[model samples]
Target: MKHLLNLLAAIALLVWGTQLVRTGVLRVFGANLRSLLARSMGNRFSAALSGIGVTALVQSSTATALMTSSFVGQGLISLPAALAVMRGADVGTALMAVLFSTDLSWLSPLFIFVGVVMYMARQDTTTGRVGRVFIGLGLILLALRLVVETSEPLLASPVVRTLLGSVSSDLVAELLVGAALAVISYSSLAIVLLIAAMAASHVVPTEVALGLVLGANLGSGLLAILTTLKASVEVRQVTWGNMVFKVLGVALVAPLIGLWLRHAHPRLGDIATSVVLFHLAYNVVISLGFIGMTQWVASLMARLMPPADPASKNPLRPRHLDPSALATPSLAISCAAREALHQADLVEAMLVGMYTVIRTGDLKLSAELRQIDDSVDELYSAIKYYLTKISRSELDEREGRRWTDIIGFTINMEQIGDIIERVLIDIEDKKIKRGFRFSEAGMQEITELHGRLVDNLRLAMSVFLNGDVRDARRLLEEKVRFRDLERSYAAAHLARLSDRTVPSIETSSLHIDLLSELKRINSLLCSMAYPILEPTGTLAPSRLQDAAPARPQS
Candidate 1:
C-alpha cells in the first residue's frame, strides 16, 4: 500500500510538473512564437530551424505543433515550411530530456520564485511570459525529482528488476517497451526519465535502456504526425519525413547499440543524457540531409495529395467550424471570430475591386468583380452557419462577448456583401447595358470616399488583431471623420443630379445610386470597428453631422 501510494504521488507530481512547464511556456512566448511562425512561410529550412529553436526553448513539441497548425490554418506558413520546422522541433525537444539528466532540484525553486515575481509584478508581456516559462521549468524538475524518488524502491524489488531485465535483454522487447512507455505518458521526455530512473536503480540493463531510448524517439514524432493529419499535404509530408528520419535513425543505430553499451553504463542519468544526445544528433543529420530537398519533397507530397482543382476550390469555406474545435469553447469562439473577420476582409476587397472596375470602365475587370461578388455570397452563407453552430454551446463571460462580436461583425459584413452584390453590382452591370459613363470628377469623388473607407477598415482590423482598445478608439475617430467626408461627397452627387445639363440620365442616375451604396458599405464597414470601439451604443449617423445640413448648390 505504501509503495502504491508513493507511485501514485510520483505520477501526480509528473502530471503537475508537465502541466506547469507546458502552460508556462505557452503563457510567456506563445504569441511571439505565433507571430514569428506566421512570417516564416515559403522557407522550409527557416521554418524547420525556427520549429527546433522554439521547441528547444519552450521544452515541449506538442506546444510547438499546436501553434504550428494554427499558423498553417491562418496561411502564415506554407505546409512544406511547417513540416520542415516540425522536423527541427522533434530534435529540439530532446534538449529538455537532457536537462533532466542533471541534478536540477536546486534551481527549480529559484526559477519558480523568479518566474512568479515576474509574472505577477511585471507590466511587460514578454517579461511576464518569460517568468511563466521559468515557473513551468521549476514544476517539471520538481515532478521528476518526486518521480525518481518513488521509483527508487522498485530497484530493490526482485520481481520488478527481473521483469525489466527480461524486457531489456532483447532488442525488440526494449524497443517496444520504450515506445509503449512514451505512448502511456503521451510524452517522450516523461518516458525517457522513467527509463533513466529505472536504469539508475540498476533494474534495467544498458542495452535495454538504449533500445527504449530509440523507441522514445519514434514515439516523440507521433504528436507532430497527428497534428499534420488535418493540415495541408505539404505539412503532412514534413511530418512523415520527420517520422521516417527518426524511425530510420533507430534502425540504423540499432547495430551500434553494443558500442554505446560498451562506452556507457545504462545509469539513469547516462541514459537520460543519451536520449538528449540522440535527439540532437538525429535532427542535425536529418535537417542537413533534407534542407535542400524541400522542393523534391513538396513534389512527392503534391503527387500524393494533389492540389484541389481551382474550379472546386471554395473560397467561402468556413475553416473554424470543425466539430473537434467545439470541444474547446473559447478556442472555438476565437476561431469563429477570426473566420468572420476573414469574410469581412474578402467583402472589403471585393468592394474595392468593383469600384476600381467602375472607375476604369474596364469590362474585363467588371466580370472579375461579379465573380468576387459570387464568392462573397458563398462566404456569407458559410459564416452564418458557422456562427449558428458556435451559438449552440455554453459560453462563459469572455466567450459570450466574443460570440456577440463575431455575430455582429459577421452580420455587418453580410450586409456589406449584399450592398456590393445587390446594389453595386446592379449599378455597374446597368451602366454596361445603358452604355453610360460617369464624368471624371464624379468617379474621382466616389473613389476617394472608398479609399478613405478602406483605410479606416484597415485600421479597425489592426485594432482587433492587436486587441488595442486605444487604437480601436482612434479608428472610431477616423470613422467619424470619414463619415463627414462621405456627406460632402453625397451632397455634391445630389447637386449634380439636380442639374439637368450636367450629365445624361443614365450616367446621372447611376451616379446617384452608386453614391448611396458607397455610403451604406462605408457605414457597415465602420460598424465592424464600432463594436470594439463603442460596444454600448450604436454607431449613429455621425457623417450627416459634419454636412452643411443641406445638399450642395447646383
Candidate 2:
C-alpha cells in the first residue's frame, strides 16, 4: 500500500509539472505563438514546423492543437494546414518523450533550487513565470525518476506480478490499456515515458510495451476529439481530421509491431531503449506518411460533418468566444476583445439606422434596428461571461488591464444598445405615431450631433483595438466636443420653441430626449480611451482641477 501510494504521488507530480509548464509557457509566449501560427499557416510545411516548435516549448501538444484549431475556426487557415500542424505537434511530443527518456536526473535539484529562488524573488514578473517553467521541468524529471524507483520495488510482490502479467497476455488488450492511460493522463508523452519505465523494470515485456505504444498513440487522437467537443464545427473538424490520421496510422502499425520488435530487440539491448525508439519511429512514419494527405482527410471530414445551413445560423451568437481558448489566458483575452468588437459592430448598425428612423419616422426601420439591439444584448452577455472565466492572477499587469478593458467595453456596448432601443421606441411613439417632424433648424442640429456620435463610436472601437495613445487622447477630446454640441442643439431647439415653429413645438420633448441620449451614448463610447491613457499620465486626475486653497482668511 505504501509503495502504491508512492507511485501514485509520483504520477500526480508528473501531471502537475506538465500542467505548470504548459500554462507558464502559454502565458509567457502566447501572443508570439499566436502570431507565429498565423504566419506559418500560409503553407503546410511551415505550419507543421511551427506546431513542432510550439509543442516543444509548451511541453503539451494539446495546447498547440487548441491554438491551431482556433485559427481554423476563424477561417484564417485551411483545414489541411491545420491537420499538418497536428502531425507536427505529434512528432514534437514524441521528441519530447525521447528527450526525457534519457538520464537527466542530475539537473533536477539544480533547476528546482534556482527556479524556486527566482520565482520567489520576481513573483509577478515575466522572469518569475519563466522560472516557473524551469520548476515544472525539474519536477517532471524528478517525478519520472521516482516513478521508476518506486514501481521497481512493487514488481517483486506476487499480487503485483500477477496483476501486471495479465496486461501482457493479450497484445490487443494491452494496447487498449495504453490508450486509456494516455487519455486519463491527458498526455501521451507521459504515458509513453511511464511505459518505458515499466519496460525497463521488467514489469512489462518489450513486445507488450510496443503494443501499448500503439494504443497510446490512438488514445491521444481520442483525447483531441474529446477536448474539442464543445468547439465550433470547423474547430471540431480539425480535431476529427487529426484523429483520423492517428487511427489510420495506428491500424497500419499495430500489425507491424511484432515484426519490428523481433528484428530490433537484439540490437536495442534493453526494453526501455527499445520502447522509446519504437515510439519515436512510429510517430515519424505516421507523420511522413500522412503529411501529404491532409487535404484528402480534410475532404473526408467535411463530408462526414457538412457545414450548417447558413440560413439557420444565429446572428446573435457570439463568434469569437471559443471555450477551448479559456484555458490559455492570452488567447481567451483575444477572444473576448474580438467578441466585444462584434458587439460594437451591432451597435454601429443601430446608430446608423437611428438617423434615418428619426428623419423619416419609419416604423419599419425603427423596429428592425430595435431587434438588432437584441443581438447586441446577447453578445454582451456572452462576452461578459467569457472574460470572467479567465484567471486574473495568471495575467501580468498588462494582460490584467486588457482583461478589464474588454469587460468595460462590452458593458458600455450593452448600455448603448439599450439606450438605442429606447430611442427607437420614443421615436415610434412621439413623432412617427403623432405625425410630427423637427423643423429644418432642429433637424440640422440633430443631424450634426448624430454624425459626431457615429464618428466617435468608430473612433472608440479603433482605440480599443490598437490602444494608440494619440487616438485615445483624441477620443477624450471628441467626448467634450460631443457634450458641447448636445447642449448647443438643446439651446437651439428651445429657441425654435420660443418662436413657436409648428413642427418644433409638436416634437419638442422627443427632440430634447434624443439629444440627451446621444450625449449619453457618446460618453460611454469615450470611456474606452481612459484606460489606455491612464498609464500614460495623459488624462487629468479629475475632470475639474483642484481649486487653489486661499491663504488663511484672505
Candidates in order: C-alpha RMSD to true structure: 8.6, 2.2
TM-score of each: 0.65, 0.95
Q: What are the per-residue Cα lDDT tens digits for candidate 2 across 158-246?
A: 99878767877587798789889988988887888888987888777787888898889888888878877988999999989988888
Task: At residue 102, give the lDDT of candidate 2.
Answer: 88
Output the worst ten-in-a-row residue range by lDDT, candidate 1.
322-331
Model 2 residue pairs with clashes: none
User: Per-residue lDDT tens digits of candidate 1, residues 1-554?
Assistant: 57758866766666556655665554455456666666765467678778777887666665566566555445556666766777677767766677676788899889889989987986345577577667767777776677667777767778876787677568887777777666566677767766666556555665677678778767767655764566544445555655666665677678876765566435524555664565456556666666666566656666876755758756656555433233234445667777777776777777777777676667677666566766666766766666666533235345566677777776777677777766555655677666677766687887787787787667666665665667766766766677787678767766766775344345766776777777777666666566565664545657565646677798
lDDT of 1 at 431: 79
lDDT of each: 0.65, 0.87
Model 1: CA > 4 A from native: 34-51, 65-84, 120-127, 155-166, 169-177, 180-186, 266-299, 319-341, 345-408, 415-523, 531-554
Q: How accurate is candidate 2 locally (lDDT)?
A: 0.87
True lDDT of residue 278, candidate 1: 55
| lDDT score at residue 339, model 1, on the 0-100 scale | 78
